[model samples]
Target: MTLAGCVSTPHPEKNTTAIPVAPEPEPVRPLMYAAMPDERFPIPAVKLDQLDRRFWRREVDYQTSERPGTLIVDTPAKYLYHVTPGGRAMRYGIGVGREGFAWSGRAIVAYKRQWPRWTPPDSMVARQPSLQPYSIANGGMDPGLRNPLGARALYIHEGGKDTLYRLHGTPEAFSIGKAVSSGCIRLINQDVIHLYENVRDGSPIVVVPDPSMSNIAVSSL
Candidate 1:
């Protein structure tokens, strides 16, 4: 199926199964004002200027490699590196998994969506029954402040099934360089927009086990 046509599909057999395929939610409109003509957020830009420049610098890098378009995320450094030819990579700052949310493995950008809808996993809903109302059947939440997925989402999958993990955008700019999400990695909205425009579906994504001691050296000025 074409990427654009990969929204939810009904499974008729789901009716008899214990795990009901929850009805797909309605489309959500972004809560933030639309991106302006210049692509800046409608809201005030986050005061990144006050934060440590080293942190921002750590987020991006370039590494030349034989694998062509492979991207790597060094969770310890809170950086995502997009590998380029000739031993260079473009790196971006990222927010990684919290203590219990950390995941390490190989995955692919199975699908991507612009302004994707937010759907809490069934496990989450079970823990917080109050969330049941917001389950996918209720058309999910209108893309707004309450939504956790932010403005863009790149769904990651392994072995041809959704890992339920994602590389998505976040309104909480302060979370960069910190571990404080369910499982997916988060990026600043502006940075995610930049990444979304550059990466394609099915791209190779390798989330390294840990960045602190990993010897994966990347080269770039």
Candidate 2:
């Protein structure tokens, strides 16, 4: 029996080849600022490397008492809150005004700038004549190292006039949880970047009075 299932014949032509396909690349996000060296300054010995994340407290389910589009600076808490709808807020750590520079008022953000030029105020220049050379009329200091305004600035105005107060960034990240500014509210460069992304020109700001002083007044009564 030759068998019903037995056949062997040579077939020499068969082709098998694999094809390759490349993957699509991811889109890149543009950076807000180029990487740069830190400016020279008389920096204090604060432990910036050890950031206390606990200093920033957000009540997840709790709504802010403030209203939307209003800025609230809680000096004692060292936090600045931008009230949003539904009781939420965009909170940021800040350096508040020092004792003599503490102030409270309603103001509008008149203008904002990136890598802003800085000129010492005339009064500041008068007290420190060395700064006289850097006054605004003298073209102000060029943008770079040594400008106290840091990376960005938002000028505050009241009654259609500049109040000479500012919300600005600082290289001194360690100052984030302290009251050490001359009169302005100081934010870390990173935090200010976050804030700058959220606000627009002419945003209203309501600086609250220092709680300690308010408490003292209440106790005195």
Candidate 3:
């Protein structure tokens, strides 16, 4: 009388049946280039449709041996990449210097400012006598929408010296993705504000050489 009472064999209907899963929702991309009325001088929205999509500020896959938080400015490509974790970067379109004026080398973000003053260097004032009023002695141009440094400016320094080169904003949005600045790297006002908020003092930045030039010297701002 072994197990005499009752015995029942149980079996799963089918082990191959898969449970239904909900699909993942698409990532939401914020409109980063929008207007900011809260700013001291209300910032207008960028004309995105007029600008090339490649030049837009966005995160991208960046292949580099450098550590995270490093900034690499690719002169020829007109791209400035702030390296983020996980082999990614926040890339922004930048305006480099024209023919005779260009800067390259590794430096640190010595300091940054919001709505920074624009002091035309003596060399620059010499070239454009009209800028004499904004010379360093005049306490530089007051921070405003019309200011050359735009909404933000990051001072670049190397070997414990101010390189006089800066990563700054420009009211001339069209200047982006072009080589027309005196020497400093320029970003659109909106983009500059975004970058200024992210980068910290002492962050490393490397402005690569422009291969088009015969001699890539680290020039002044």
lDDT of all predictions, in order shown? Answer: 0.69, 0.68, 0.86
For residues 1-221, write the lDDT of model 1, one tens digit per residue: 65756677668877644676898564342332234334322433544543334445333336444375676887888888877666677677788876655776777898787667788888878888898878978877766434677767899888888888899877676888887777688877766766787788889888876545333322221
Task: Give the per-residue lDDT digits (tens) of candidate 3, residues 145-195.
Answer: 899888999999998998888999886767888998888899988899989
lDDT of 2 by residue, 24-89 (tens): 543231232223345233223223453356444243333655468677777777888877788778
Could you tell me the lDDT of residue 84 within candidate 2?
Answer: 78
Ranking by lDDT: 3, 1, 2
Model 2 alpha-carbon drift over 4 Å, by segment: 1-50, 56-65, 211-221
Instruction: Name the top lDDT candidate.
Output: 3
Once superposed on the true structure, which residue ranges of model 3 sit more than 4 Å away at CA? 1-30, 219-221
Task: For candidate 1, give the lDDT.
Answer: 0.69
Q: Give residue 156's error in model 1 in angstroms.
A: 0.2
TM-score, per-candidate, Cα-based: 0.71, 0.70, 0.83
